[model samples]
Target chain A: MERVISKVTFDLAQTSLRQVNHFLHRELNSETPKITLLNPDGAHNLAVGLDATIDVEIMGHTGYYTASMNKQATITIFGNAGTGVAENMMSGRVHVKGFASVSAGASAHGGLLVIDGDASLRCGISLKGADIVVGGSVGSFSAFMAQAGRIVICGNAGDALGDSLYEAVIYIRGQIKSLGADAQIEPMMEADYQTVGELLAQAGLSYQPQDFKRVASARQLYHWNADADQEY
Target chain B: MCGIIGLLIKQPHLRDSLGELTVPMLIGMGERGPDSAGLAVFTQTLADPYRKYSLYSGGKDFPWQDLSQALQTQMSKEAELQPHGNQAVLTTDLPSTTLKPWLKAHYPQLHVLSTGRAIDLYKDAGNPTEVADRYHFKDLKGSHVVAHTRMATESAVTPAHAHPFTAGEDFCLVHNGSLSNPNEIRRKLEPRGIHFETDNDTEAACRFLEWRMREGDDLATALQKGFEALDGFYTFLMGTADKLALVRDAFACKPAVVAETDEYVAIASEFRSLAHLPQVKHAHIYEPAPEEIYVWNV
Candidate 1:
């Protein structure tokens, strides 16, 4: 069968990448579509909520919700992305070559989301299955309310990262503000570091695995007792 | 919303006595999902059939007596069904080999499904205390469990979609996060005669596991494939009859923490979930590895 998305096209001059999504929805019948964003300056939601076999390559910066609710596609944002990039994505790969704004990849489920640059507040907030590898720092409340998966922050994190979280895994190489809710800092053994190292490598991020510290929940928030008037 | 908890022990002594430990643990998590509570207990029976006990309360479904009586009559005989106001319980004794068929025959209303070696489930609309009081969780004890306290974003508030669903024998799951590819996966699985009860995305995860299991993939391998195949945000806790496992989506948008020592290992959405444990001395907590799978054997 013919490849889902075979041709490479650019709509920078055409303006309104809306047609791109519409075209993709019609043409690429696969769960993921192979796309090439040709230096689009201000495209918003270039590939959000597309559940086909598709791969997207953005050569330039993007606007909000670049890949929200994505499934089975590989998205590469060659330049910076605006607010809420990859929000609530389900399955697929999202790679930002440059910085991303607040809530990048927030609440995403199963998939690999890699950010080559720094991210703003609520990065990965309330995140579910998504695995995030940030090459740079994360803003406050990273992985907040996170239910599962791994988030490796290559740089420092802002205040209250991982607050009130459940079972998500986090690894950071730099300083962090107070841990939120049940989150805690833990030592990284060789076996653990090796696993972290390999995951980072798979995300195409390079760093000294030893330099990172691991963050997780203390398992306190999973329960609440009314008679005791306590919240876990 | 509803509350759920599943545990799997590594040691045989711990496994056999799981009922004792799990009864209280489920009650402890009851507050997180207070709207309704239910517990399913599994015991190993090589000679006899696999045994499953389910206890829950009918919170606002109808009057307490009416709901309880209906449940009791529906789950009578083979499964001991008891309803007490906001809580109810059901027990079934079966051989391990017949667990799958037993679940299919008796708990079809639950719409059970599996994920890797663990079962996946959904519970809607209940508080932890309400769940315990309604489900009679005090009577439940098992080697392993995985539960949830639903905020009710999607799906109904019915008991049919509650957490700790069973896919086959000895498997259950609790999850946090949304699945994006449920329709696609559902469309694929429905043709295979795999039934569905609710509209929740987690059912896709269960069907994904069932598909992988049918293909002869081991639990861990199936989970890894789930990591690659399923789409959406998910940080899930799963339990077999004798083991507990955790799986996170690639983004890790949600949070999961683990506190461990030589004696016990506790996982939760927050530290307070395990803070009640008296044995937790200076608990060291950390997040699951990205795209990682953690298993505790019983």
Candidate 2:
């Protein structure tokens, strides 16, 4: 574990922390490495575009898009993350210790994203091939445009749940307001319970699988049925 | 609720002065920073550009040439030269605009607004369009711009303290935060012949910028020094003829957002201000990094 950034300097400190990803991508040849930041201020896009199998721990509250475009590295934030914590994530996992803001896992592709606390609006908007598990309630417009993957909500969900969804699995335990145009409540089966339990355990949440309801898209908004088409 | 805007173009293009772009935004802010308003516009006038300058006009002459002269002379052979065509002509040809008297009656202090032939600033109490119309800023264009509207807290509300404090040939600042150690910096800058008109924290900010520029520091370096020495919470934006810089206080209390694409880079206090622009597709809006300075060349 060679410490890359232990203390801030004139060159490294002044360079935008966002560029740290570019530097890492260009310099580091090893696949599985450990990196740490001594003074992790509100830095956005810290470990973005990382394709290697690595472990990164940011010991402070991060700004927007902390592990965006992550490919194969596991990133853990010790503090709260701003909007779109793991936006467009491809693979690996991103774990947040505190609450996340709007668009928590927006348009994610693959891998798992776990939020330890509450999540804001549009938690999994435009979700694709990714699994997102939240330990608490989610705001309005969650799971909108979800093309694939699984989204498990351990707590309550705000208004407009699964609005305009596209073949994404949603599991919620608590109350849910009006569903989106294509969203519908479905009975939780035996396999759904096990899957929800596994996702909850991965998100570090303590809850029973049967305690929640499973909601998903009916795939009504997937294709444009001209006969029934009005507007998107 | 102050208004802040930053523009950085990769190619050579005319910059919309701080007034033309920010007046509307400040007008939108309403009375958030009604006491004063200021702007810093940057342009690439020379082949290679140096981004800041500190103008010390009212300072008493010392045994040797003042800091401005010595540094200008030292950096003259680099690429660009200081205001050399006519210092007397520039001083005497000061705009006959009514802001001087308006400032005298309204803002009695913080009048360090003289920079080279360019770097003109127009600000006062009232609406942003009113000030823009009064100064005819719509026609004034440059490369980079930064503007601010002021709301008086601890200092007297006046026009002289209005933002866009011009230091030298083409250096200016528009600040949204307060300075914790004004007296300390003032004590050091005053004796070196620096004269201040306003008691506002921004005045000290202008003076501190001028002092750093005199020490041969560029806009970004001066801003880095500003973030280090100037205590208290602040979200200040500065500009030279060819550079734009943003500095945040150590605490990161104030808010700012930066958005960039292949075409342009825009910054503002709120994302809605930038939402109107169509080019902003995937903007990463966030708070400023604590104690960090972000600078861009025009």
Candidate 3:
């Protein structure tokens, strides 16, 4: 009753961000189960490069690259993120309870990012082998050039969604502004519905799986065409 | 890279704390731009036949009292000069067409930073904290503010090259990205009686917009022309006597975040600079869309 059980607090306003990051990088065991950060106040590089499976809860807004290159750790942000949140993550989960700036979950090899609010331009740009579920709308150029992964957006998609995509699949439940080069709208199949269902269930969304449209690459840019007179 | 910050006070009571809130925002951006910093504050507009001119001596030992006395004797009007080290604000009941030529002939070393009834400008070549402290930015009271911290990518690290560049009265602009067509814009404007003081690309943008405003185009129209004429990436934050405007280029490569509360609207190149505002956590925060004009009135 005196103190919160199984939790540690690091007030960023009282201490430097480097100390908390150092602890996350070098220190931490079963004795410390959950680490909570207070007054992040748009600080960059918080809880990055963590290989351990610990619970991290950030209290306030964060600057760029929050929880980047994360592995096996479950990190959650209570406020908005600046840019590139959970970028290049290997595994585990990163969730933003609020809106995110550009390039959220960018170029992650493997992980899951669940954003409850909208994401700005270039969300999941150049993504690789990560599962991202956005509850709200995504800005322009979402999932551009994504090589391998799955992005499920529950709200509207902005201009040029999934440009020049490869292998990665996008399921959006709302209107599309336009699609980029070689990114085509395709009919949803049984596997696509299952993928959306699993991702949405994990992201805590209850939307019907049939309400989504699938976008994938046309694969026309995969080979060079010399006889077409430069028109694709 | 550089940083741009703007704050527009929506409530009248919040204007008194404008400087106090903005000083930390400017200092927070020091990491992005350490070479030079500048700010333009738009206060209550004065009546007709009186204008406040922000002047800089470039050094700490300028004889401001002597200049004041000289102006009082020569102009036959009550001229008051508020002196603070190298910076001074000269309030006169004469048009700049008369005062500017006189100052040019009398004191050539003095650089007129801004000439308007509602704007007081401060800029220098130094770190953002040092520059704000040197100019007493925490003491500035205004309805709105436009400020910049420069990294010296397109120009030298001189005070003249610092941002929040002003052209016509009561209008100023700060840019966060470089312009590829500044020389071309300069070539088009120089023949049209628009003067440029530095080779800075942001200066080209500032003058272009002000010239459009002077040619009877409103802020929105001028910005539309700016989009068609200016090339390259940018996130511009502009301030007028009664408004604060923000716009990004088509690519939106340069960053800008806005936080809007009931009392104030804060814009910065990044969220870190805007994190210290009062009630910012509860404010409606979002990134501006590309090629869109957002204007907040004072």
Candidate 4:
């Protein structure tokens, strides 16, 4: 016996984002899967707060907070995504076929956010434990204040790549204009290469891991002291 | 929070659809700012010898015809007043320097939204759709348009407090974040003969830029100086007679997206505001870096 996949479609032009989100919450679960969102038309807060192992596809561009706080949902945006995509996600995957605006994957705990095109400023800002892979370039402050996670960029990185980073690994294949406070470029070991290779493979990218540089925190500025203010 | 949208048509053929294209963008930002809305339109038709001034009378039905007759009598020149709901556009051959002061000295109640050779402004405190309909915004024709929906974080909601603040002739600015040090800057500029109309912090930024320009700095230089002087988390869209400029604060907390096509350049607080634009899918979309100035010339 074969199992049937339940697929639901919602057109945002005729329906509100709230109604779509409500339908997603009420109908989506581990048992019933798949939703097709049409005519997103850059609406914000679409498919937010999803905690099921379902497949959600958005046909067009979306505004802020798209697929934010996702626990276990495989979401794909066919078009561009606005600010804060997949922010604070716990699990599953979110893929963007087009460019992502500022804070593409900010403060996510766990998930795989794959951006096919360039990501704007603060791509992985305050990231906790997610894995982000960008197929194209990323804007400045790529991993600012990231406590934990891994970010792999197949292309270049903008200024101040990993500012104030902590316990997070950043891999960039192209040039890094500048590094932020307490962030330093480290020699990639064999294990680090393997990690980058795995992240690229998971994001369905074919970049070579040997052509990348690893950036990590120096751990010197972890603790503050009033007496160490001579530079100020 | 506030919403900002700007459209500058590069193709001469698409210039007539500026207002029709801008209404949807402004309305899309209704969730971000539901308090009031304002817009400024620039057309080539207004490039004649006459100057146009857009004025708001605080929702009052003022004697616009009488004011126009008086202005014609006093200035000894032809003047025309066209009213639209609570706002009106006054066109005259008088220079802004003479006309603005005269209007200020006489009708203090009429708030001048903008004055320029090619710009006309309209704004009010209400829903963005209702405000746009009241002024027949969909029927307006222009080469470029800049619109704002205000949430009023720093000041009370009034017609005077709506955005697209005009400081210099043909120059207007709309802000999306709060300024931390406006009063201090206001006090500093007050002694230099810079007059302020509203207590809104955005007005302070507008006046500061105008003052910088008055000091012989070009628009780009003034904006670079603004990065050093202004303190806040802001994304600003400023318009001149022939250009549109954008700048974000160093922190880049506020959101802004810029999309450019061969036919046009559009900016908005979010991507949704620009999603309805023509051929936006093929447009090159990106976010401006913090402290970077992006300017588009006509």
Question: Candidate 3 vs candidate 4: which has greater TM-score?
Answer: 3
**Cα displacement (Å) at residue A188, model 1:** 28
DockQ of each: 0.02, 0.02, 0.67, 0.67
Q: What value does the lDDT take at residue A99 in candidate 2?
A: 71
Fnat per predicted structure, each in turn:
0.00, 0.00, 0.58, 0.74
- Give the candidate number with the greatest TM-score: 3
| Model 1 misplacement above 4 A | A1-232, B1-6, B9-40, B45-125
lDDT by residue (tens digit), candidate 2, B1-298: 4566565554444354433554454454445565565455554353223222212222123212232343345433222223311111112222324323533454343233554544544456545556555445465566666677677677765556667676545666777667788888888888998877677777788778978888899666777788678888787877766667787764444556666766566676544345444355444444455466787776
**Candidate 4 error regions (>4 Å):** A29-32, A224-227, A230-232, B45-49
Greater TM-score among 2 and 3 belongs to: 3
For model 4, residues A1-232, the per-residue Cα lDDT tens digits are 5677888888998888888898778855546568999999888899998988889999988888899999888999999898899999899899999988889889999999999999988999999999999999998888999999999998888888888899989999998888888899999999999999999999889888999999999887788857877441
Global lDDT scores for all candidate models: 0.66, 0.67, 0.92, 0.89
Error of 3 at B108 (Å): 1.2
| Per-residue lDDT of candidate 3, residues B1-298 (tens digit) | 8999999989998888999999999988999899999999999899988899999998799999989888889987678899877989999888889999999999998999998989999999999999998989999998999999988887799999998899989889999989999999999999998888999999999999999999999999999999999999899999888999999997788889999999999999888888778899889998898999999988
Q: Candidate 3, TM-score vs. the true structure?
A: 0.97
Q: Give the candidates in order of DockQ, highest first.
A: 4, 3, 2, 1
B-chain TM-score, candidate 1: 0.72
**TM-score for candidate 4, residues paired by index:** 0.94
Q: What is the lDDT of residue B61 in candidate 1?
A: 49
Local accuracy of candidate 4 as per-residue lDDT tens digits, B208-298: 9999998999999999989888898899999888899999997788888888999999999988888888899899888887888899987
TM-score of chain B taken alone, every candidate: 0.72, 0.71, 0.99, 0.95
